[model samples]
Target chain A: MPSPALRVLTDFKRWATPLPVWSGRLHAADWPLTARHIRTQGGRLLAFWGEDRRAEESAYLVHAAFLIATGIVRTEMVVDPATAVYPSLTSIFPNALRMERALYDLLGIRATGTHDTRPWLRHAAWPADRFPLRTDFPGTDLDVAADRGYAFPPTNSPDLHEIPVGPIHAGIIEPGHFRFQVLGEEILRLEERFGYAHKGVERLFRGLDGAAGARLAGRISGDSTVAYAWSYAQAVEQVAAARVPERAQWLRALCLERERLANHLGDLGAIGNDAGLAFALTQFQALKEEFLRENQRYFGHRYLMDRILPGGVAFDLAATDIAALHGAGRALETAIGHLQEILAEHGGLRDRVVQVGVVSPERAAYLGLMGVAGRASGQAWDLRVQFPPSPYDRLQVRMAVAMDGDVAARMAVRFQEISESLRLQEEILRKLPDGHPYHPLDLREAAGEGIGWVEGWRGEVFFWLRMAQGNIRHCRPQDPSWTLWPVLEEAVLRDIVADFPLINKSFNLSYSGHDL
Target chain B: MYRILREVLRLGKVGEKPPRTQRDPASASPSCFRHSLGIRHVDAGSCNGCELELNALNGPHYNLEQAGFRFTASPRHADVLTVSGPVTRHMAAALQDCHTAMPAPRRVIAIGDCACDGGVFQGSYAVVGKVAAVLPVDLQISGCPPDPDALLRGLLRISGEQVNS
Candidate 1:
């Protein structure tokens, strides 16, 4: 059965009507024309990638963008022999700005006629001529010298004071610098300099075969380990067209929801704590601890690391474990419901979150912002509802959206998602089918590229993997944080600097995710 | 406000006394001082796995403060410099600078395998191997991310606070 996306691509010319997703390959010259048409139809660029296949002059650049309203994911391929730079889509889709920059950093495929040509992902440490993602770019044992500093946008105003924070912060959070140009307490501009946590994650993917790559995928961002791991597995399986057992599919969904629960619980509490309310912190953290302990008891690891693999999951739910999880859900529902009421009535907390860090629906869509934050900002594009996998397709997922786009909206989205996840978890346990949970991948499946997308707790976690000769050829794990981090700089604009922490917590963008 | 008071009252003090890592630290290592372990954490290039476990340990359950484990903001005030990740290039200098900021007799602890010998990220171009590659690590707590309890145990042992049976 051809995918609906593929069907839409084939039928693009036949019908005058716009589909949710319209995708197909295009000639290098026709790229701009196709992109313009998509833009006119209100499509947004989700991800742009250049695949550096060193296999005898047959390399191509791939672009995947979403037309959200119709749930369309149009995929296009480009092959160039001369100046491999394609027409700049950033002129059409603003969100493609950083992704296009990263393309050049990785594969030397510059977006010709693009607005900004600044080095992204790769900093001064890497030499100008060296592109790390090239097939010949031996990623091992690179001796990098910190040769230069980043070219941050110049602050021309003399009245504005500059304050640089992080890469190493006051709290136990991850590293990523933020440069704020301000007047008194209000801000004029905020610039975020990430890639400080860049661990050569994409480069490391080449060192492992399919199974081991799953491990690296999970490690891409630990909080979204389940999402990344599942995405990676789905990509590998899609290429192989492997038949995953019904039971395993259900179990994978179960793990995904548990991950969603754990993160939402933690973030809700953290957001409250950041707003100067300590009571919410204790209650929520305690509840999260209970959730994690149950994860450890059933799944063998608290964070569910290495639990997901190539064709299926590593573990199956035991009879007693399912019963226990069901019981835990009931307890969690009551506890969360009680905590939710307290947070709703708390006036001080409400004031801090209400109008602070507002990202308009227009800006959110322009940035291609996703996950809970996107939903909070009135973007009703949840992959589970739009383009779901096997188990999720069967389950009814209510897409939550709020127009306010403030910290309050974000918190409200999390609350609603938590309850939804709990509901899904109980339903999954009630209807789990019996079969083998793990299927070993066939070696013959190592020749083509496949894309895996999952709506992780932080939003959408996407992975594009191409395997050849029993090893990964090119792997690019796109974290939703890359899109949302830029919005944080936008979100914190004009707000007093002190409220940065609260705003930051509401979005809770991942440095590792973007840096990777 | 009343809810806050009642919650705090119910969740009183942490139950256990600080586990004595050792009967005495002065005898084992004359150069070291052990009492309150002020830890300064530097995330060189981790997946945020170790940090989460650390957060969990500090929260109501493990109660890191009860065990005399505290996370300090400055290396100057810290006795142990706890570092995680593969020591990414951008962070290499910062890690060295943080180690430099600590006065003499300061302990360096590498948390997670990524910090130990680079773990899964050892050969990657962006990193400079491990924590020991850039700093003089006294103890290495191993695991993709070592369990928070294991990390606490490593600290007590390295700080000469672990009571050897």
Candidate 2:
């Protein structure tokens, strides 16, 4: 049987012509199909992006693509580069509502049919005339941003009053403003304003060499540092058609799983604490601390930042560290078991989380939800299981899915994932492949387009890289948080104002991850 | 009831952690002894690595609250303003406003490599550089995202305590 993507491509070729390009295949584009034909096929619009192709001509167009379960991605570009306005995909996909606005904010591309376009990420950071991502545009002029203002949508009904929270929260957190129109604790509408934490990372990528670019990817979202770095490394490797040593591939998997494990532990604790269960917080927090200390003692950095490089990992595991890791994994397993018992005993905690903040299974699939959140809501999609780059294909991942789609479901998924990661960790250490984990990546002269995808703790972290003359032309690290945040607006519908914090914590989407 | 009683019995003296008993660079501050600290953290534009480390301070191990330091929700009640990130253009005004909200004798500490000197993100178009660019910094903790030990040590400095960097 042809792969799922090959089957679609075969069918598309019969009806339409195909267009292809080179220069390391930096980005994906092809002959266009009408929006009607795209919707007819059973495809979900995974991500919508833009690439500045000024060198080809002062030309650029926004890209929108759909990814299906069969390891196949189909791309269809809308407007010609010369024409700035094009039809939007939101008519077909709800997720594109945010992506199209962001595409316009950064690149000055407008979507003709998009409904909500009241500035997604712009937040008046630049002048109306200037698109910062364009080639000819100069850097930010501070005066413009200072004088700029945002017209946040408001409600006028007598009973529906407005409430504004954050950009700066009460706790140790990132910033973003959420304005809600409420009628006596019932939220009529909730609008979110971001770009408060925009660091201009995509623009900064233009100034980096390949290796330097890899370092920045790790810092994209500290929690997913390993996943982002690995994604970038895989992209560089794909562009050059380089083969990583078997040892290095296994080592990378180890780090990715460890990153996943660490995040799950931390979130499990935080989610419990937010629900007003202090005991669960203490138990899980202690477990998380133990795990982090192990990571630091072995991996050097507690968060594993800058550990994964473009070629391979920066450090190698010694026999002693391997032994230490083995022991630590066993200890964690036992501790988690005890924690699970405590969780089971606390029935009141379950009531708080059980049916609270439910996302229907059909909506999750339609919205293209990802990672832990997706799995909890019965979206059977994972990059590692679907498109295993190397080690995971052989690792035999066990998929977990829950139809409940509640805060409890998400937490349960996290728990199951932690168990699975621990099992994978032990198996990897036992079947330790011998050789050097560090490989020298020499991409200084290499140029091409390559895509790297890995199943991060949150979901899938995707990186698209284009290189020329040994310098980065474009780098896009698509954090799963970008997909999760929009779905959160849907999830919080009608929930009481007090439950918002509990619900928000359950998803625990990253502001920095989405802001970038 | 049976499990709770057994656990209480099993749990021995949860006494002082040695690190807090020492007099450091922070104990030298006269106000350190007079007032308990309430820290309000702000993330201008960090990668969230620093925020993760900061969050860990309240975890079971370090437990900053045990040492008379608690994270407060209101800047009005805060005795110190802790900020991270290389002050993004959109956040510059908010940072200034947050700093101004704190009462006088407020200490401002810049944590993480980004906050100290803008680290990897220095000279970017969007950032206004480090905390020094937006607010006066009293103590700066260094590292890409300083580990819990480094942060705890630096935090101890508010009480007039000092330790090896």
Candidate 3:
């Protein structure tokens, strides 16, 4: 029973023959060694290639790695002035195809030995030659008319019928196109084409100063606002060596848990609603409203956006607020217990969800899934438990896990997580340290790269912030949606197209988060 | 009839319902709203604030379907075009085409601060500022991403339903 981090690190240390030393700065020389290090660390190879941005003199090769045991991630970049193409990781990791193609399309980075070079993320709307992420590229001129119709993969057989669900869905959900190839009721293949909501979030953060950058991060995905803000703050804070007060850390955890609880409650309710259980929807909606109202009463925003800043939290919780939070937590616990009882007794709801949209434990492990979706499938990789950056470490958070890998399993994980979050929130409120919520960090302009990992309601949210001369050079906000979206496709296999919504809702991966 | 009576008896005492008159009027519309919106949402390259708020609109607080605002599966069937994010280059055409596909008398609601006016990503290289830059927006709900309540109000306004406030 070694700690998850230690187990992962130890396995990785053995996997790679030549170990690489920790470099003070993420420079060009460290790329190869880092890649080797990641491979030895039981990490699934994702992609490796150079990106030539005309704005910078030196070109760089970006490498993505997904660690298996702990779901820890490492991305390496090396500055290579020479035009040397690296071999593709597709042979080693089949899933690297989509990511490699996306990198190629967005950054004009070429990957040698890569089998597929089809355009992804770059629709016909943008000039085929122009790469938007590069600074030197002129902005897209909207005045010109371009072909808007997308040619999806065509299925000729009568058995292979296509079901185009949305870019606009029946429910009030964000837009994304899901084209299902079904054989009668069972789905044979599911292809998702999104960017209907593509808002170049990464490129938007390129030039903003740290303070302004944090605000943009908070809005990355509204439900995960606290998680994104904290991750962005963690990156900046680490780069600046800024120390957040213990109380601020505790308060950050409280906010994160509240966000987690709020989302889980809503998700549980929505999952039920999707299953045609109106009673569950009404009950859960009422609970969720009360949950959000409590958030508004304490934090100015119901979603807790902008509550977290670079140095510390934007606002401090008063004693009265803490008392109110505790009271709310108790009430939530009672309500959740009652809801669980009802869910258990309702055989109709149980039958609909149980064994529906099953993602086997093996597949979940292979995909490197994270968050509640991964946990439900028995991959208990939680950043709070593994990384535990300060308050979580002190609080001793325990992750909730289930092995069924189905819609019901996902719901159970949500229920258990809500309960766990309530307990954690109470603990945080009870032992909150007394001090200023923020301590201004007199951060200087220096080039540094730091990784911020936070267990958002959607699993692990990873942020990579690179700063040069007091301004952000690059920011990568990786949501678990990147991993889970594919899993949703796999889970829907053998299920009818009509049941897709129920299955999809159970794994609620964020389209905007992925599009970013 | 006997089975129906037995089923009613099994459902223990129903909790006190909120006063019928005092209940939020916005929550009383037919539940079929999700079937009607024929919604086509476009992201004009936002900081993602509007998108989050858009997500909140679907969540528990103000379930949009309860009020007759549903998201459609395609632009051809949509009655309203909901655009969020500051209009960006990658999405400009899709945004326009989605609007064009919808039949006449369709309403366009810009749901977030970014969609209303680029909000934080106002002057970014990738952003085209506001949704108005590319399309005719009928309603604007302003908040970095408006709260779920504010989003609900904006949708209600578009549906020709009066807001209680």
Candidate 4:
């Protein structure tokens, strides 16, 4: 007899993507049992979303994509319209708590077994019973409900008190509320309330064509625009059965690396600022600005938004562009080397970050923490390495891993990733492929679903697309921040309230991405 | 400390010279606080693209502080309020309360295309159209995200007649 992992692989038929994927429809009764079986086999739940399929069939379909040993396996099950309830996977995968809550808030589906049923993305903005993502819900109704309040569980201790931070933070940052229960300076528990940044992006993708949908995907999170656009393009290409040109693949890789370098440079500086090194902030910000300016010079957009489209990239690089890229990489490498030495020798910086905000390897694995944060805590699961597609597969990419799982570990990972990105950029420029950059896509007759998996700067970004005759039916773009945000609440425990900013910056999970 | 000082001096004065522009009387800074403007920023429901440009205003290149503009942590201490994003239903109340908290002579500057007139996110059920729909927008700087240079120029115009770097 084979293990459950192998057994499940046989159960689902293979699906095509850059990553090895197998997808199948399952009976509703087997949803929880299959989730438990995969959890027992040490598989990680990647993303979970619900779709309103009432127009075609009078049932709602819920989908779960899991990261097993081989690759990604997506499973879907149908829920009857009468009950509109499905068994919860929260007991098996604790990270599913928010996704389940959000599923309920967006669609009117109920997760029968979860304890916490309070709203995740709905903040009394609409009526209590009104579901936004349903096919029947009018997309333009502007009526709002009065505040009915959320239930943040109270601490029983007389000694501990709560500190409610803002949906409007002090700095020039996105809005999300954080509630910390503290005894003096030390934190006992932390609960987060988001949805202040939800723009109804998924609903906006309903009738948009491939080009408009790709543009909306890029804006899903501005920082990871390239990743989201590339991912969205890949999903469309898969569904349309179009093969992107060789040069287009290389250019996409180049844009992805540049995006990674820019974000990491900005984050390293912010982490230093949080550690009380103000000089580091100015220096790093200058480096990142220079990098972004170059992005505008070469790629046409600083953030590389809309550079990627359905079948391929919008443009190709000239020989002079390639030479310029090589030159920029060398200069950045030299400057970063100098900064790394200074940061290493700074004692105050080391003391502030070395052991703070620690999440043990065991804790990280159990909680399903992923991406650069996961890599820092010894979760060595980079999609670039695990399931390398195209350029990354050929680049022989190196994975950065640190076992300490502290602020220092995360900073080290960011620095290492920056160096690796520069090296990758140099290699890509040296070996530039010759071909057209784009292939125009026509998905008018395409009627199917596909998934786009890309290792975005923060972590693995998963985009699932369901379309009929070129028009999108449902699309869910999942950010790794969904799992990382809960881990942040865990990282804050037993640490002082003042250190929250430092800890949060170390992880640098996205508020807009998670809220959407 | 010596290396840090040396590196700092080596990279001396990366700030740019301010662009010359005619100032509009409608959005001009009040005479009392013209020397420096303490601005408070509210991210009503942005994609953080506008916030990125806003942060760059404080970076060494644009250096709005040297040009007599800075961000304040409190609304009460602000002379101007810069808002980004089309106002979301969840954030509308908080944004209104923030505006009400400001002292008299308070000016509102909408920072992005979305904030200006609900750019791409217009008419969504969760969105409240635009920043002007909720607050009295005194100035609107439009871009998917207005670049740092545009943001700095807009703020400097609000600061006074003389915009300097």
Which lDDT value does model 1 have at A336?
82
Tell me the DockQ of each model, to 2 decimals.
0.59, 0.59, 0.28, 0.67
Best candidate (score: lDDT): 4
Q: Compared with the true structure, what per-residue lDDT tens digits does model 2 show for residues A55-163? A: 6756675654456434335343435566777666676777778878888888888877656777777665677667777777787564314323567765777878898
Q: DockQ for the candidate 3 complex?
A: 0.28
Q: Model 3 in CAPRI terms: which quality?
A: acceptable
Query: Which ranges of candidate 1 are over 4 A from the true structure?
Result: A1-23, A58-62, A65-74, A77-81, A138-148, B2-20, B24-33, B163-165
Per-residue lDDT of candidate 4, residues B1-165 (tens digit): 888887688668788876765444664567765647889999988888888878877788986777678899999999999999888888888898889999988889999999999987887888897998889988899987888988877776776654544
Q: What's model 1's lDDT at A473?
A: 75
TM-score of chain B of each: 0.84, 0.84, 0.73, 0.91
Which residue runs does candidate 2 get wrong by more than 4 Å?
A1-40, A74-82, A143-148, B1-35
Worst 10 residues of 3 chain A by lDDT: A14-23
lDDT of 1 by residue, A1-516 (tens): 223434444444221111133446666666766666667666666666767654755765656655545554555666574666777777777667788888788788887887678887876556767888777776544544442478788889898899988778877889888899999999879988777788878778874788789888989889989999998988787667677788888998999999999989989888988899878887777888878889889998889999999878899888999999999999899878777877888899999999999999988877767789999999888888887777988888888788899999999999999999999999999999888998788845477666777889998887877777768877788888877888888899989998999999999878888888
lDDT of 3 by residue, A391-460 (tens): 8877888788999999999999998889899999989889899998899876657467666778899887
Candidate 4 on A1-516: residue-level lDDT in tens?
224554563477787656678887887777888888878778899999999988888899999998888887798889998999999999999889999999999999999987899989988687668888998886554544423388899789999999998888888989889999999999989999888888887888888888888888988888888899998988888899789888889889999999999989988899999889998989988988888899889899878888999888987788898888788899899888888888989999999898899999999999888899999999998888878888888998999999999999999999999999999999888886888889888888877888999999999899999888788878999988999999989898999998999999998877777777
B103-136, model 2: which lDDT tens digit per residue?
8778888999999998777777678889997788
- Tell me, by TM-score, which candidate is best: 4
lDDT of 1 at A460: 87
